[model samples]
Target: MKKQLLVAVSLCAGFIASAMADSRVTIHYPGQSQALVLQGAANLEQLTLRPELNGRTWWPGTVIAERTASGIQQQTQQQTQQQLLARLSAFSAALRGDNDGELAGSVDRVRTQLAAMRVTGRQFVPLDPDWIRLHAEANRRLSGEYSVYTLSRPTSVQVVGVTTPAGPQPYQPGRDVAEYLQTHQRLSGAEKNVVWVIQPDGKTEKVPVAYWNHRHVEVAPGSIIYVGFSSWSLPRAYRDVNEQIVSLLTHRIPD
Candidate 1:
């Protein structure tokens, strides 16, 4: 009877140990053919200190994809896309096919590019150990299958929304945001006075580009300059469309 009891207790301990084990995390570095797998990393602080991350020029916009949150993130993204498309269609209808359809065309191109992107539970958290140590939320315990992507520095800034042939433009160091806008011809119905700058760290800023209110806001490499539809041109019901677009762009996966 004593032997039987020992076997049962051992089985219970084994089950408890298995249940308490940390989930596996995969670390992907730029230009690396194989990913580094880590087990038993308790939190972001521990993961960032791994030897593999040493001596690398860490991009501040590093992404962490948590498997458990992926489904919810995907659903939220799809819903936002649908809402934006519906509003854009309504805006075009209000225009009665005016402005040579340039506004509608440009917006459609932006939406297409966004649609092609894969939606994941990507969290744009700063991987700097110092930053993580200061912010309790950033240092939270990690679980599930997490993919940590350490991306390389980008050379170009993407200029999209209400621009002809919306895409990437060469990023010039110390160039003002207005100068970048001048290079890209704004399509009809584009906002003239202010443009939105979405930086790689998932921060958004509204910058003035008009001659009267122009501010020398430096455009960072790997940022996105969005020249959205003029506020006056938007219908009352869809007045916040530009803001929504900026929010959605923040979630885009870096190339």
Candidate 2:
């Protein structure tokens, strides 16, 4: 009887141990030919201590995606994309009857670019190892696959929306937001007083660029300078389109 009891206890313990095992994680470093695969890391804290990650720079905009959440993330992105597309189509239709051909052309250009961009199901999580180590959730087990990308610093910023000469421009240090606008010609419907700056880390800022309300907001590298459509030009239902565009741009996968 004693032997049987001991055997049952051992089996139960083994089952629990197996149930708690951590999932595999893959870490990708910049310029490295090979990726480091790890298992048995209980959480972000344990994963950060691996010798393979030692002495590497951790970019503030580092992206971590869990494979388990990819499907749901993809669905969410698709819904958002579809909504944005619908809104853009409505904007185009409304502008068709209006006298502003330049504005209509600008909207069409943005719609085309958005439709062509690829949507990856990857969802970004903050997951900074330095912060994780000091947090209460450090002991929580990490599940599914993880990709830790240490990307190189970007050297250019993308300028888009309602502007000529839109696209990537060489990033200049200490240049204010208004200076960047000077290089590009804002379309008739573009906002004159402000622009939205979407940073690499998914943070958005409203920056004043017009002379009277001009505030010296510095544009960051890899950021997108979105010159939005003027509020008066957009119908009531589409007034939030620019904000939605900024949100989508924030989630965009790094190139």
Candidate 3:
């Protein structure tokens, strides 16, 4: 097995600044009614094929070999909001001021919408070094095992979307970055799983397996891979994760 490029993003939001020293963070998500203390960072892809490092940043998506009752689907923040809105549409109809995700086949639409944003845990009131408060305004009616919340304002999502009805967005890698790594090349067998790399655009990068040819490779923060996913991983997951959370304005979170 090789440490493929993985992007574990989103879960980094709302971390308690009380970080120890090395790289441990206690994240308190909305609807969680609890906090998650994760050390190091990793992604579902990396953790699936390698060892986990405590106290590091994390990644976003997971590459599953097959689908299950709970499979991950890539989605944009707008899509997430639209889906949530649709859930409560019957009670709160769009007064002709809606952007999308309305009308006809709502039941099936709701299921598909959730299926896409579904990570592996409860939906969250995404937080950040800055303060942002999202409430269970819309999805309150449909809340259950998977809690939900709505942003106070609009936000953007960066993860790449694949196999969408509209198809994945244009993802042409940058020439500057591509050329830089090509010139700096000096990796060996499986030892190359040092730090994962992700483009700011939200698309994931592989953990380059040029070193030992082993299955796994570790990485550094802001380098690559954010959070990890697996059977032994965290009990909860997050959907609609974004950068620079701006939902809660009551308090300012520390970066």
Models 1 onward score TM values of 0.79, 0.78, 0.20
Candidate 2 least-lDDT 10 residues: 118-127
Q: Which candidate number has the best lDDT?
A: 1
Query: Each candidate: what lDDT?
Result: 0.76, 0.75, 0.25
Off by over 4 Å in 2: 1-21, 24-40, 48-58, 67-70, 98-100, 119-125, 134-141, 145-150
User: What does the lDDT come to for candidate 2?
Assistant: 0.75
Give me the runs in candidate 3 sitting further than 4 Å from their true place.
1-60, 63-88, 91-116, 122-165, 175-255
Cα lDDT of model 1 by residue, 124-215, tens digit: 67778888878978886776667776767788888888877678888889998898877678777789999999998788999999999999
Per-residue lDDT of candidate 3, residues 137-210 (tens digit): 32111111211121221122121111112111223333222222322322111112322234321234444334
Over all chains combined, what TM-score does candidate 1 have?
Answer: 0.79
Model 1 per-residue lDDT at 237: 83
Model 3 scores a TM of 0.20
Candidate 2, residues 93-118, lDDT tens digits: the string is 77877766767787887777667654
